[model samples]
Target: VNCNCDYGCPCQFNARPTDGTCRAVVAWRIDSGHFGDTRLDGLHAVNIYAWPGAIHEGNGSMQSIIDERASDAQRTALVAILQGEGADPGAVMLQIYRTMCTAAHEPLYEPIHLDIDIAERTARLSIPGLVDSAVEPIRNPVTGAPHRARVDLPFGKEFRLAEVASGRTRATGVIPLELANT
Candidate 1:
């Protein structure tokens, strides 16, 4: 995930954004999963979002991009899951995000290239002509030594533990974004 915020996004802590607005591009690569018997392993998806104010204030724009290699059934299942269908209300993060957005653009099918190594704190994601993003370990400003940190949310719906890293993103789709060191 990359956004127009400082290295540690304040939003995660329920704080306002660094700037007064919010814009982010988040991508996920499913290593192993199933959506109603439709295998979602090795598939990738991306979500781009922007808001004039805090997320809870509404009036946001969002778009989804899915891997073009997925089959028809896989595409349908992915779309359904991402759009928050067939899940208990507000149980999934995507569902909550969808409700906060006023504009939800049509999903796009595109070629996606994603490589992630969570243990190494490195990731690279690219979609031809659409988005390019990367994640890397954070470094100390003075010593230039790699800094490691993690956020643990015991009851969080989105995740239980997350490694904090630096991220950069450039997107040129319906919801364009250019984020650095976020």
Candidate 2:
């Protein structure tokens, strides 16, 4: 996930953004998972979002992208899950994010390449003409050495623990985004 915020996004702590607005590009690589009986393994997806104000204030726009290698059935199932269908209210991050956005652009089926290593605090995501993003360990301002940090949300819906690293993203789509060191 890359967004226009300082390292350690304030939103994770329920605080206002570093700036007044919000723009983000997030990608997910499903190593192994299942949506009911559907085998959702080795698939990737990306979401782009922007808002004029805080997320809860509404009037946001979003675009979804799915891996082209998925089968028809896999695509349908992934779309449903992305749209928050059949899930209990606010049970998932995608579901909650969808409700906050007013404009939902048509989803794109395209080639996606993603690699993530949580322990190493490294990641790379590419969607051809859509986006190019990467993540790496934060560096110490004085020593220029890799600085490691983490965030743990005991009851958070998005993730239980996340390695806090620097992220950069450039996206060109319905909801464009350009973020650096965030």
Candidate 3:
């Protein structure tokens, strides 16, 4: 969730985004999954996005990057899923987001690197020539000790549970994304 939102994002609570605009670099690291016959284990993906105002207001742009390690079948399947064509309608947020966006770029293939520690609220996700992003535990402003927090939502669109942390990201793509302290 490396987005252009302030720490403790208001969107989580149905409030407006801090800056009244929305753009982000979201990702998924598939530890294990299957797309029909092709195995998607150890694959990674990124979705870069930009929006005019509030997300629900519509009008946005999107770009995607998929791991090059995947086979042609895997790539096709992944692209379909990203375009909200491979899943049950309205089952996932991508379906709705895909509809709101005005543009979706051609997917890029690259070697992805990802290391995630959910408990530690940390991750490093990179796609060469596309994006570099990292998340880490927030630090106490006063004592400088590691601060830990978690977001729990019984009916959240993004996740039912998530660790809260500080993050940084810079992306190079058709829909460029840049944010810090996300």
Candidate 4:
């Protein structure tokens, strides 16, 4: 999924996480896949955490976690795809995950929880010990009104618009995501 991290992520600014450095964890479960003749079925999850001095500079480190149930071939294919291989160029999902990463960590196997309700402006992503992130509409302080902000990237491979707001977050392994006063 596409995300808004301050004005410029290290990748965009040729730097690290907007707050001086770069660090984030991205995990996903593939419901289905077919890399050539290889069948990738069942539930699979992977996590990527990284810290870069500047995203464009390309010297950041990263950690990858994959589901233990995957076969050796499946694991290799997923890693390659996540690392920006075999996919179309300019595919933001793969490109962004790859270019900005500098260091690589061993993959882990674990359960990941994910839920999304774009229409309701709510989303949650979490892992037992790795991450827990949530997104919702921003609210007005005095009236408790929900404020909504959208960033449109017409050419971006991700969504064209993203709602920014104040959200509650609790992430330990990666940088904590707290939607605050957007």
Best by lDDT: 1
Q: Give all TM-scores, in the order shown.
A: 0.95, 0.94, 0.94, 0.69
Q: lDDT tens digits, residues 1-182, model 4?
A: 32235632324333345555545545565668767777777655644444444455567655555666678887787677667777666665656656666556665566667676768777677678765666667666789777666666675444556555444444554334333322
Per-candidate Cα lDDT values, in order, are 0.89, 0.87, 0.86, 0.57
Where does model 1 exceed 4 Å of error? Answer: none
lDDT of 2 by residue, 50-118 (tens): 988878787889888989999988898888888788878888878888888999899899999999887
Global Cα lDDT for candidate 3? 0.86
How many backbone clashes does every candidate have?
A: 0, 0, 0, 16
TM-score of model 4 vs. true structure: 0.69
Q: 62-156, model 1: which lDDT tens digit per residue? A: 98899999999999998888777787778888888888899999999999999998779899999999999999999899999889988888986
* C-alpha RMSD (angstroms) for model 1: 1.2
lDDT for 103 (candidate 2): 93
Q: How many clashing pairs does model 1 include?
A: 0
Instruction: Give per-model CA RMSD.
Output: 1.2, 1.3, 1.3, 4.1
Report the lDDT tens digits of candidate 3 across residue range 34-130: 8788888889888888898878888988887898998999999888777788657678888878888888888999998989987677899988887
